[model samples]
Target: MRTIHAPRLLLLLGTSLLVRGGQTLRSGDHERGDVPGWVMITLMSATLVAVILFMAEEALTTMFKAAMDKVNNP
Candidate 1:
């Protein structure tokens, strides 16, 4: 029969307790932790899109006009 020494048994129990405590602390919900970072990223992406649209407005308009003309003429 394998017998656990008192010190070994105490160490095993403590390790198991720590593992269980860690698991309990981590609630398994999908954690969205960095709200501000995501918000900043989203804002930056939107700003880039706005700037690109502003800069390319004339070109985009011309392209659309050409595409429509081709479609209508076809």
Candidate 2:
């Protein structure tokens, strides 16, 4: 089974909710800002994940393997 980080998931969920709950930008606001809060958060999150994986590929891979081994062998 794959493990999910509950904290990160909840953080993202809460952030999206906050973004949606706030005042919506007008159509003209797109001229000033390229994207909305939620969109920026999503893009930044994906980029952050990619950068983290690139920087810690070996450690993350090892941890994943260890977890998988534990599950499969247990």
- Per-residue CA lDDT of model 1 for 2-48, tens digit only, reads 97654465556556655654565576544645544654565566556
The alpha-carbon deviation from the true structure for residue 14 of candidate 2, after best TM-score superposition, in angstroms, is 24
- By lDDT, who's the top model here? 2
Regions of candidate 1 where Cα sits further than 4 Å from its true position: 1-30
State how far residue 35 of model 1 sits from its true place (Å): 0.9
Q: What is the lDDT of residue 56 in candidate 2?
A: 92
lDDT scores for all predictions? 0.65, 0.67
Candidate 1 residue pairs that clash = none
Q: Please give, for residues 1-74, the per-residue lDDT of candidate 2 as tens digits.
A: 98656456657766775575453453334444534565668656766776787689899999999999999999
State the lDDT at 66 in candidate 1: 100
Can you give the TM-score per candidate against the true fold?
A: 0.57, 0.41
